[model samples]
Every structure is written in C-alpha cells, then in structure tokens.
Target: MRRYGQAVLMLLVGAAVLRISLFSALYLRYVQSGLRPYLIASGALLVLLGVAAGVRAAREVPDEDETQDPHEHGHTHTTGPRLAWLLALPAAALLLFPPPALGSYSADREDAQRAAQGIGTFPPLPSGDPVDLSVAAFTSRAVYDSDRSLKGRTVRLTGFVTHGDDGTWYITRLLVSCCAADATTSKVEVRGADAPATDTWVTATGIWHPKGRLGSSAAWPPLLDAKAVRRVEEPSNPYEQR
Candidate 1:
C-alpha cells in the first residue's frame, strides 16, 4: 500500500478533473465548450494510467535479502521521479474551490489596451424598444458607429462589474474567440446607476451615451447611461463567444 501512495494520488487528481468537467460548469471558465469532450477523454486516460502504475507497484515483490541482487526497496519498485507526484496539488485545487467564469477579478487585471471585437460598420438595430444585446455587439456599435447607432435606443446588457479608476465602473464581459486565454474585454462605462461590487452579475437597462470619442483600436468600449440597475445571478455560460 505504501509503495503505491503516489500512484493513488495521481488517480484521485485525474478523477477530480474528469468529475468536475463532466458534472459542473467550471470547465467553461478555463476552456470553450467544444473542448469539453477532449478534457473528459484525456482525464479518463490519465486515471487509467495511474491505476495501472498502482497495480504494478503492488505486484512487485521486495527482494528479501540485501545481498540477493538488492537495491533500495523504494527505488527498486518505484520507476518514476517522486517530484512528479507534486503536480497533482495544483490540479486538485480546481476541485477544492469552484472556478466560475472569469469575473471582476479577471476583468480588472486585463490590459486596458486590449482591442474590442466585432468592430466595423454595424447593421441597424433590429426594430424594438429595449433590444437585448451581448456585451460585444453593444460595444462595437457604441465604439465604431459614429452616427450614434445606439443613440436614443433602449438596450439590455448583462455583465459583471469592473470597478474603474475614475470612480465609475465598467459593465464588463470577456469575448472569447476560442477560450478564456484568448478573451478580450467588451465593456461599457456605465453611468447613472451605482456601480455594483466587482464580479457581481447584473442586468442593466439603459440608453447609450453618445459623446465620448472612440479611442484607438485598444480604446475602451463606449459608455451606457443606465436607466436601471439590479443584481442577478451569473449566467450558466458567462463568456461571450465571438
């Protein structure tokens, strides 16, 4: 049993990743949904390998006498570096604490110079009052469409709060082309309503602020003059797919 302790630890960690990725939503925080199957497959394989190593270690008989072709008992049966066992600690952290989609914590750390996605001439807003929009779609229209595509239009935007330096806050969401690693901010400076705590999810109904100069490619998304602000639950899939 002692001989296979490290192998058992590996098996537990691999099982953890597989369990969380399959049974929980945190997997969406680290990677895209399309990659879920691959993670499950890979985790399963690692677990099987660990089990095999444990079985092999248990089957090996210790040399009874040091003089009878003996070496250190632990080294003789254990074929892998002990240091490799430490990798399991970080892998297990995910299971210890639930990982939600990137929230205010991640958004605040993001570079202000990151470019907005979906930039270009925007099509006319589909006819309606209080049109629903993704953070990316709203940001592009607000930033690039100079004729005020969003002017006088009522809109609903859902996002977490990114506390800003100027005492205001950004209603923010990350736009991921493939995964969170490649995500960029698509935020709007929200005015009129009190800023919510960082990472707190909320739905805001608002009209666009029509005056700020759209900065360079790396500029922040345009501001929204919010009509209402209220707390809400985080969406099941939080990142905006670009």
Candidate 2:
C-alpha cells in the first residue's frame, strides 16, 4: 500500500510540471491572486513528502535467504530518477522569463470584440463626478443606435492600445471581469495629436462623438476634442473592474 501511494504521488508531481509549462495561461485563468501562493506552498510540501517516502522505499530490501523469494517482496520499481528533473523545468522557465498578459494577440481575434453583443442605455452623467461607463456599455449603445444617450458628453475611461483602422488613433481599453480567459475588448476611439503609442495606458477625457463605424463589427463614439491623453502604467488588475 505504501509503495502504491508513493507511485501515485510522483505521477501527480509530473503532471503538475507539465501543466505549469505548456498550459500556464490556462492555469492563470482559474487561479485567483491570493490562491496562487497557497498552491505553491502546498505543492512544495507534497513534493518533499514524496521524496522522503521514495528514499525510505529505496533503503528497504528483503534478506537474500528469506523464505519467500527476494523478488516477491512488496516493492514496486519506479523510473522516477529518470523523470524527476522534468518536474523542475517548468519552474525554471517561469523564473527566467515570465510571459506578458494576453494583449494584441487576442485583440485582433474576431471573438474578442464585445460590441457584437447587445447594447444597453446608460443613464446621464452626474453633475460633478466623472461618469464611469464600461467600454462594453459605451460600444453597445453606439453600435445599436448612434444618436442614443452617449453623445456630446465629457467621459473618462482607461485602456490599452491607441490606433484605429481609419488612420485615426484611439485610447482603447478592455474590460475583463475575471481573468484574461473571459476578457472582452472595448475602446474609446480618440482622434487627436496627443494619442499615445500602441499598448500605452492612458486615461482619456473626451466627449463621445457618434460618427463612424468600426469596420463591419459596430459603430462607436469618436472623441472630437480630447482634453488630456497622458500615458500611464498598466494596472495590476489588467481586467476591467466590475
């Protein structure tokens, strides 16, 4: 029973290594921020326990002249020594070069745009405080009906990317409720000299101008006179704050 347990534990470690290597993006999607540290700690503890059990099993052997044959002793041979190093390779890659958040690669994918989904009407902005409407909300309204409620009002939004198909540029942003797996792209297309470079974070202050269409996908409000377009670092939580 002990030998069987040790074999199962080793196989689990091997599987974990492969998951962290080829499917890191998938792993990141499911594991939330604080949960990651706990996973790492638990994994380390299991690995150490397995190692100890393996060492003990290696030291136990039947006497040569026992009543039963030595080969019949309750030990199962394992090829663990040959495969144990594979367990460390994934960790090494992450330590040396961590991957960037899923960005432009997903942006160009047709399924990434949320405008194709239904649009909703946003209430009027309050008199003093800046109104915070999601890129999804803004795009939905404009796509369904250009002359909806989001016109001629000053708005504030944050996102990455600052270019458009019509030679004009924008300060685009994405709203991600969870991880990158479910991220939906939405942008406040701004056209002006102060437009930042691609992928640069910017907080844009401008009025929504419902004029042009985003290819065949949907119509969006354009920024006529952007008051400010200052570049800022990407937020820790890259997804849209729900």
Candidate 3:
C-alpha cells in the first residue's frame, strides 16, 4: 500500500474534484460556475495520471532471484514522503461530506470595503411594481445610485440572515469576483420584519428607506422597510457572481 501512496492520493483528489464539479453543484460553494469545465477536465486528468502511476509501480517489481538494491547500480528510487498521505484526508472529506457554502460567518468578516465606487446615476429599472433583484444589485443602487431607482418601488431580495452586534439584522449575500476566497458581503438592513434564524434563507419584499446622502457612511447597508418575509430554500449557487 505504501508503494502506491502517490497513486492513491491522486485518485482521492481527482474523485473529490469530480464529486463537487461534475457530480453535483457543490463546486459553486468554492469557485465560479463558469470554471466547471476546467475543473472537470482537471479531475479527469488526475484520475488518469493516478491509474498510469499505479500501473508503472506495479511493473517495476524486482525478480525474486535479483536482490541487489537499485541504488548500488547508480539508480535511486524515489517516492512521495510518507507524511504526504495525510493530504488525502481533506480530499476524502470533500468527497464524502462536502461543506456548505459561505454564510453569515463569512459575511460578518467583511466590512465596507465595497464603498469605494462613488455615487453615480444608474439605469432605470424595468417597469414593474415588485422587481426582483440580486442582493448585490440592490445594495449598489441603494447605497450609490443617485436616481434612487428603488424608491417607492416594491423590490424583492433574497439572502441568508445575519445579525449585527447591536440587534440589527440584515438579509445578506456574498459576492465573489472569482471564487469564495475573494468573496465580499452585500446586505440590506431589514426593518419592520422580524429576522429569521441566522443563516436562514429568505425572500424579503420592501421599499427602500433612504437614510443618508448617497455614497456616505450613513447610506451604507441601505435600509429596507420590509412588508413581507418568506422562508425559502437555499440557492444552489449561494454566492453572487460579480
């Protein structure tokens, strides 16, 4: 088994990647959806490499009558470090019990790093009473849009619930530029509606409650006067693509 450690490690890693990107949508929790094809290809390559390595190792066996060490003939045999097999533990975990997507804990770790986009006029929204918008879009318009496109219009936003230290609760979603490692938080302060459990997915319909000057600190985390809140299943792709 030790002789085939490298092959086993490769197979474990390949299977883990395939389990998330090819067999399920779990890859969305870590990477952008558009990268799925690359992941699948890489996984397939790894599996093939593992199989090839196993075959080569099997064929390198010495004859029973030839007990000379290969090193005595100016040849040194090399294999992966024994400790390297520990790396397979994480791969096995990923294959068996993929972790959930980033939620409130990840959201809380981010502050107002996204406020640098100065205030500007945004395009008019489509004609409708209640417009469905992504959490990132709503946050952008509410915080920086000079036109106040969301004012007086009932808008719907979906995200998990996150609580502030001061009893404030927000409907929050993470925005990823490439993958979860670069994820940023977007949220709206919910008013007039009780906050559900933390990490609970919900769709909230409300009117924009302008708090302060556009692009100011006070305008951050723009408030929404929610009229209705409904529990919903978590989305397959939890992070919003920026």
Candidate 4:
C-alpha cells in the first residue's frame, strides 16, 4: 500500500473509465454522447500517468540514512494509505459491472418536479403510419402543441416501463441536457395494454388519448391508447437529448 498505492488507484480508475467510454457504450448511461472524446482522452492520460508512476516506484531505493526507530516502525503511519484504497472500490465496480441507465426510481422521484412546458405549434410530423418518435418528442406534442399534432397519428415510442401509484403504467425515458445528474423524466401513460416488468424496455405503438386542453396539467403524462406493445432491448444510449 505504501509503495504503489497511488499508482494502483490511478490505474484502476483509468481502466474503469476506459471500460465505459473507450471499450464500450456504457458511458452513455452517465453522460451525453458528445462527451465521449473527452472521457476517452482523460482515461488515456490517467493510464499513462499511472504507468509512469509505477515505473518510477519500481526503480526507487529505500533511504539508508533515514532509518525509522523500531518503536515508530511497529506503529507505522499506514492509515492514510489504507483510507485512500477505499477510493478504488467504485472504480473497480465501474470496470467490472457498470450500472444500468436511470430507471423507474429516478422517474418516480421527478413526480413533483415535472414542470409544464409552454404551449406551441410544432412542425408537422413526417407523413407515414406508425411514425417512430422519442418519448420526449411525443410527450411535448401531446401536451403543448397547439395544433394537437399527435391526434389521429399512430406513433411508436420506446422506453422502459414505470408503474404509477394508481396502478397505471408508463413508457418512460429520461431526458438529459448533459448527464444523468440533470436528467428529467419523459413518460407517457399507456392504456389498453398490459404492462411489462418494471424497467423492462419496450416499444409501444399507439394513438394519443387526449385528456384535456393543451398546455394544461390534465393533458400531461400524456395518454397513449396502445394498439401493440413489444418487448425490446434497451438502447445503447437510453436517454433522450434535450
């Protein structure tokens, strides 16, 4: 712990970063895609620094003139190094078992913070049946669009499932402006379909079930009358960009 503790910690952290950002798409769980280059660079630099430190430590020699007294040697000052090793635990976890993207727990926490967006007119959606749309896009249109853009349209939305307090289920995706810390939930109430397991990714094809006037609270957590629901693999990037 004394000789190479810092080096080992740095290597562990750098390897963790590389595991998530450079070697795979797991970084998407924590940050926006645009930050990948920065993360990769930072991870590479840490690895290089760790390697250099290890080499320097390996070539070091104990100071013969600065011998410790036997009384002090038996009660050494190893506490700091021991505590420092604790920092490596999270890094090791990240490298071995990266965490999943934000899910129902995060979504539920946003219940009180879901602000109502101002109403506006949106551009007409592309002409097609069962048009694919992100959960955030669909939610915005269903709640705020003055023209009721989602009316009469068969849209497909994909997200993990989250249960409500009243036994209802939603297709929910987190919306991130930068990273998971600032992520907001975008969910749609699904009717006419049985819910999959919580946190299970799924694609729902449905038409908007209008509840109230646009720009009103009653219109939110926009309703979807699902015609079909199919289980799907979670996307590499689970969050919708804001």
On TM-score, the candidate that comes out on top is: 4
lDDT rank order? 3, 4, 1, 2
Query: What does candidate 3's lDDT look like per residue over 1-242, in tens digits?
Result: 56688898899999999999999999999999899999999999999999998998788775532466766778754544656888999999999999999999999887776557898998899898799999999989998998888889999999999999999999999989999999888999999998799999999999999988788877888999999999999999998888
TM-score of each: 0.82, 0.61, 0.91, 0.94
Q: Alpha carbon lDDT of residue 87, candidate 2? A: 53
lDDT of 2 at 9: 56
Residue-level lDDT tens digits of model 4 in 116-235 = 568889999999999999999998898888898888999999999999879899999999999999999899999999989999999999999998777777777899999999999999
Per-residue lDDT for 118 in model 2? 57
> What is the full ranking by TM-score, best candidate first?
4, 3, 1, 2
Candidate 1: lDDT over CA atoms? 0.78
Q: Summarize candidate 1's per-residue lDDT along 1-242 as a digit string, tens digits.
A: 44676777878777877876777867787788899898898878879988998988878885364235425443464435466666767667766865567777767776656344334566788899899999888877776665567888999999988887789898899878888888778788899988788888899999987644563554455778889999999887889997
lDDT of each: 0.78, 0.57, 0.90, 0.89
TM-score for candidate 1, please give it: 0.82
Model 1 ranges with Cα > 4 A deviation: 1-6, 63-82, 114-119, 214-219
Weakest lDDT window of 10 consecutive positions for candidate 2: 21-30
Query: In terms of lDDT, which candidate is stronger, 1 or 4?
Result: 4
Error of model 4, residue 99, in angstroms: 1.2
Error of 4 at 42 (Å): 0.7
Instruction: Return the top candidate by lDDT.
Output: 3
lDDT of 3: 0.90
